[model samples]
Target: MNESSVKPSEQLSRTLAAGSPLIYVVTWEEERLEQMLARASQELFGDDRPVWQWTAALGFTSGPGADRQLLDPVEALSFVVSESVDAICLMKDLPALFESRPALVRALRDVYDHLSVRPGSMVVSHPSINIPPGLSKEVYLLELPLPDADELRGMLGSLNSGFGEEQRVSDEWLDRVSYATQGLSSNETRDLFHQLVSEKIVDVDAALAEINLAKAQLLMKENCLEVITKKYDIDKIGGLSKLKSWVISRQKLFTKEAQAARIDVPAGILMMGVSGCGKSLAAKTIPSVWGLPLIRLDMNKIMSGGWGAPEVAWERAIRAAENAAPVVLWIDEIENSFGFLNDSATSGNMTIFSSFLTWMQEKPANVFVAATANRIEILPPEMIRKGRFDQLFFVDLPEAPARIDILRIHILGQGGDPEEFDLNHLAKVMNGWTAAEIEQMVRAARIDAFTDGREITYDDLIHNIYRIVPLSKTMSEQLNALRIWSHNRATKAH
Candidate 1:
């Protein structure tokens, strides 16, 4: 889109002049915002620049003397109302103080009302929305999204101007950088681009990767979302043809081509089953399958802090996930995270869970949430709603055939002769064992062989199985409860 097409400031000015006063702009880039305000000022007053300055060092003084005075938000707001400063008064970093200082919110509202009747205008700019309840009616909130492709291209062109051989950079690389930095600030983009060049990995793809890493860090801090860059393809994982096929069927829906064709991307999937099932593996491997990075939301980090703190963390986490779009967000042990949703004492937790459910219900198609849970009973009904998750599949312990596949995969990975192993006999003997337990038994057999200075044999596996107890045995009641619940609600993993 062209710069002319995205004139948010012009829209804001028009709104204010049309009698809907008090524009509140939420944006991360203070510098870009100032440029927008300057453009708006030029649009408002021809030839004469509208005086604007922010900072408490110099108080607000308009016209000839106004250019030098820097004032706090309250003081600037007061000056705008009292002195009738025709200029648009811009305030930065004021949202952090709005909630704490009721008086300031009241003052801004008062100034807004004063400007509503007069010719003057005031604009509040911050990276977040913090309008006080009292000022909600007076303030009009607007989001200044990150610069679009054209704006980013213009920035790159300006940055490269008058530079010699050192300024060498490919248009494709710049385009990739622009595409990667969908929610990043101008400074973040510059820092990331230079970091790539400084590290001498200036190739287009590498530069895009570097930019992505920076974005991951910022989004991680914002949302308590852990960006998992470790590679795990379907090939790394053994066969799960059914599950793999399910994922492949909707893969095209996530692409730009699919979006252009007016197809809605699938919301997400919920994988529930017994412990040691390949649910977790499927969650991790999805990023590789979709060619997107994986992000694991750390509930431990999210749960820390006093009352009402989790709300901030939750919002930040969701924002982070949204920012890292066209990616997989894995919430392992999702049961534990929302376990308290039904309890009255966990109002905060419930609030957090509700927020998450709402996000999951309405999240952009690009954000594929792979949430896994062992205890489905603890999960709230809202989470399993059709719109929240496209499909809910039960990932029970591998059946006879899947177990055989799992065994072959494990044995081949360890250089064992699958032909010599009695796959049918082993499957029958390990009826209730999970894929994890089977793997453990295999490892135990290997250990026995190494300890005895002999080759691992079927006898070693049988001996190990005798010594180990599976989840179906130890947590029989819970396993039975889950199985019964899944009878009508979930798709059984064969």
Candidate 2:
């Protein structure tokens, strides 16, 4: 909702007529809510009348006099019962109380019963919905979203108060701040702005960086979401001819051109293959290659306890990605996250997983996803099913010709002369080794030569190769099984 032009009095009128006596305003910014309520009270009841409110520690009191009591939610509820026609019992952290105390539940029921007969109501404000079954029928919930550009501008104007009445923060600065604070609440936005001012870093870019850091922490707390700038260009990654061609073909689909052409950019790609074959690299690189921002989702972070549902966190992550549209979302090693969604034991987690699955399946066509998995066997079949990914590609170990290119690329990258090395001998020696193993061997050889204070030689690399056991030797059976699985199912990257 646009909070810029929304006057407190108008919002109060809407709250008053809402059918449910218990109105829950889900928002992270308590100060904004407080300011709105205070302004509404001044308009409706006038400064002369007392408005009794309560809080836990302070028992009960009236009007602004009850500010201390209102800080403790139980007292606030008690105060609502004791006074004021059309009064509001504003409770904070009421959701937490609902889980811990059945007495609070009964007390709330009693309060609801009284409010049904009387002319007043009780209101709970939280960052998210956590309605217990007992309070579900009694409470009406409304999620208050983050502050829009106009509201942020107003806040910025107020923050820069002494800058002059006619001129305040510039529209350009406001635009930057608005974008930086996309997923944050009014309180978060205000706090970040104030923090920048307090630190005396008045430059807008510094403030934007500070906000970005805070946003990173907030998204990290969710575990499954990350905000990252794409770092690698597609040209830098070698030897995925077919996959590269496929991705290049859809390049326009991720741009405004595709939007005008009414082409659905496609949801995402599923990269299935043996480990260390560039699945992860490809996923991370797509955002950069396609000129989209990248967000890496690590499912390990989503299982924590919090103020809201885990599903809400998933939705928030997905929404943030979509909000940053024309963005690439990289869900690396995704099989672990969705592997058990089919199991009844992980139903809650499964439910959350399915929500993500649905989004990936039906997300706005512009939000491209690039998910990578090492083990296709563990992934829920539905995920790899044709339509989920525009295409599925198998990233096998580098073939003979690809190995030569990969070695040359790595050697050149390390300031070594590619012409100095015996490429044919190295490729032959590295047979059955994964690209990752070849890279590792080159690193080991470099270190071996450095230890002896000598330049690396072909002999050093051969020695390194012999020293380490490659996956081809260790997991031959499994690799063969996997190759069979991918034979007809996926497009080969070779």
Candidate 3:
């Protein structure tokens, strides 16, 4: 938990050199962490100090007690001592054992304290570890970063080595493979390569599908989030001309030309608007139009008690988003999810909130965040003070012209020809209605068309439109309050 800018690998080296008793690595990448521990062992204690690894299933390997199996975690933790031999012990998946055994925890603490001056170190690696408060001072936590572009490139090059010169990959293929493998752990990337080698094919196009398949599998296993595939074009969005223009201009920020000019990536947008407006749809359109993958975070799932602890669930969701970087992350109904950013939140909420703020400020990945909220009043000032989001746009009820656009878009989508319906007249009649309400009206008209057993008549649409009321009409007071809150606070989206 040291708040330094040094890399995690460098942090581990420094800790071992300083004779730190126990180093806790919080990661899922045990394979890569082994490489770090091995390098550190050589650097700190020369080649003579053996780097030992232990698991409940396979214990005490590559050290003085080679081939010896210490299945008991307490017995295995004894390697942390033994001044006669300098050993770097890697503890794998010991959290479950520690949770059930209190004596092992005491032994770990005792061994940690006793090995203060010895040339020995204990490295515990787990997906998530709950260290006892008693050993908090003795244990130092290290975070293993996800594979970067250079590491990915090397991994892909290894795969290419298996192919002949005639099948050697071009620079473009290698670049695409590296980019596609971004956010994957070192072990995952290696698995991808192993699969490629087994299949005896290394086509770049096929690699993309396999990489995404791996990502989809990872997401399916997560309890706190779901993956949303981009299927719509940006033009499908009805209104928000101003917002559309902003996105079109900012699209250049990601281009090679913009990079040449040293332009930074836009932070993202916060679309605060009335309920049923195009806020959520607009967020999707931005990435869809840009040909970028998109993912939506399920805040309800994240806050669900069924998904383990809320803080842990939230952390997993954040890491998932990071892994799916260079993609737009949509968090809908933000205020209802995170609550006011004011300091008066529950301890769990505060931890989640702080983690988000820290990531927004210091995240190294290129994940573009697009958040939407219906109730801006509940949001705290610190969240919107600046720097978090590039712009805050207010999406109110569509005006007369935008209503026509929404009607046409939805009608065409429902396999109905817009030319048959009087869109201009319908737009005027559906005054103060949100885009979502208009979409439902279109569906209602289609149902009426089927009920009549004939081609749809304009009267069918008009009749159905009168039966349903929009959110603005049903919740006028609340809508007005939100409008007032966003007047000076946000830019007009339309």
All models: lDDT? 0.72, 0.69, 0.77
TM-score, prediction 2? 0.66
**For candidate 2, which ten residues in a row score worst on lDDT?**
48-57
Which is superior by TM-score, 1 or 2? Answer: 1
Q: Which model scores highest in TM-score?
A: 3
Task: Give one digit per residue, the lDDT tens place, for model 3 in 1-494.
Answer: 56465666777888889888788888888877888888888898767566777777877666765666677788766654653466678878776676688887788887787777677777888887678877788788877777766667877787778778866667666766676677678778878777765675567657666665677677777766666653566788888999999988776464334433666888778999887888888888776555455678887787667888988888788777787665677888887677553433576766787788777877743678889988788887867768888899999999998899999998888788999988889998999998888999888888888887876678878998889977877899988898898888899998
**lDDT ranking, high to low:** 3, 1, 2
Evaluation by lDDT, superior candidate among 1 and 2: 1
Candidate 2 versus truth, CA RMSD in Å, comes to 6.7
The residue-by-residue lDDT of candidate 2 on 247-267, one tens digit each, is 877765654345546666677
Output the lDDT of residue 198, model 2.
Answer: 61
Q: Which residue runs of candidate 2 sit more than 4 Å off their true CA positions?
A: 1-16, 35-83, 86-89, 93-121, 127-135, 146-177, 193-212, 219-236, 241-266, 286-332, 335-369, 377-380, 399-405, 412-433, 462-494
* lDDT for each residue of candidate 1 in 277-356, tens digit (9 for 90 to 100): 78898888877666566789887677876323878877777777776666788998787886553453277777878888
